[model samples]
Target: MRVTTTHQLYTARLPNGGAAVMDVRSGRGQWQHLNSTAALLWNQVIEGADLSKAANRLTATLAAQGAEEAVVRADLAALVSHLRALGLLAASPAPAPDPAPMHVREVLPAHTRLSLPDRAAGLLALATALFLLRCTPIRAAIAAARLVARLPLRPAAPERADQLFAAVRRVRSAWPGRAACLEESLACSFAAALRGRAVTWVIGARTAPAGAHAWNETHGNQVIGQDPEDRIWPYAPALRVRHGRNK
Candidate 1:
């Protein structure tokens, strides 16, 4: 008799307190909301309990609430379908064998180098801009300036035009070199600053007349540069609005 082994599955926790399980090989996915009933079923399944026994227990508990036997059976069938689709359960030609343990590894190499100073300064500037942009009653631009002043290290003083140009240039240079990670890090920094503020943060990209570019806008509807409309989303829209100007 030929024997087949059921492949192990993986699970990920979602931001909304839900859980998703998937088969690495089959690419099937299933999601379960962490409600009281789901929590009870999950505990039973995880404790090496038999599937039919678990279903019976679930049916008995819900039956007390006037749930019909057919409804309980349907729920159990649906749960089984979800688990099978996610590769959590499988019927081998023979009886099922114990699943192997799993392990996870880091995506990026430990040796990857990052410029902490540049990244930190960029984050600080992003935070200051978001705070000023989102606050009610619209505090003076000095509030923004003061926030920037509190950063550990400051970019060199420059003319207003120069400062804007530098920020644009830095982002442009970083994009090609670090790819998605760099973009994601910058977006995260920008998002962190905007948290709890009324402003919205959108990260978008578009092909510009010059090249593909990304930029932000604020509530004032001001485009920050000559190419502000280059089809990109900025870190903070409110801050972008205040700073953006049409060429």
Candidate 2:
């Protein structure tokens, strides 16, 4: 089997010299923590190394610490099996796309509201996002939103984008379950897309705290739903789903 990763995976280097991997294929988002040994193997796989190549590199590294080549190879093979079973390792050499580069500016002002129709659309979008997140993977959910947004509608104005963001927040306020940044950001972006507004949904990771977050931003480079007191600025985006000109 090839040591390829799926597009649904998000990885980050920890501040304390470890690695974090998240599988968002399921909407719930499963996590797998990697130790130093596992991280070495993961790095090799991510860099497009074949099984034998990864084994050679791992054996050499382990040898420096006086480990036997046979033992190291066995351990590597076992670890690869575990990872493959977890759906982290693709069976073929299909390369996944790189993470979107991070480029963000000041936060958008929170002073906007939607009209009656827009409010209805926004509410429906939030409801759809909530329901889909419970059943489908994040990738499918985002794709659904993109499909809906493909209608020949005009691009949303800056104020409209702000209004949709607020609308999503308002709708989420009434939800019984506590919605984190991931759900909130995805819902907001979906709502904007429903109105033919193309925004970017960003997944960012913070090194110091060793955590991840999600948020939305407009094409003008203004971050949506960002607050001065929140931890938004501390997290660097690890992945982004771009719709328009947002860089």
Positional deviation of 116 in candidate 2, in angstroms?
3.7
Deviation from native of the Cα of residue 164 in model 2, angstroms? 2.3
Q: For candidate 2, what's the RMSD?
A: 5.7
Error of 1 at 164 (Å): 26
**Candidate with the greatest lDDT versus the true structure:** 2
User: Where is model 2 more than 4 Å wrong at Cα?
Assistant: 1-8, 12-19, 25-27, 35-37, 58-87, 90-114, 137-139, 146-160, 220-222, 236-239, 244-247
Every model's TM-score: 0.32, 0.68
Write the residue-wise lDDT of candidate 1 on 164-196 in tens digits.
Answer: 323423444454433232133233224323321
Question: lDDT scores for all predictions?
Answer: 0.35, 0.65
User: How many residue-pair clashes does candidate 2 contain?
Assistant: 0
Residue-level lDDT tens digits of model 2 in 167-205: 877777778887777777788777776776776676656
Report how far residue 161 has shifted in candidate 2, in Å: 3.3
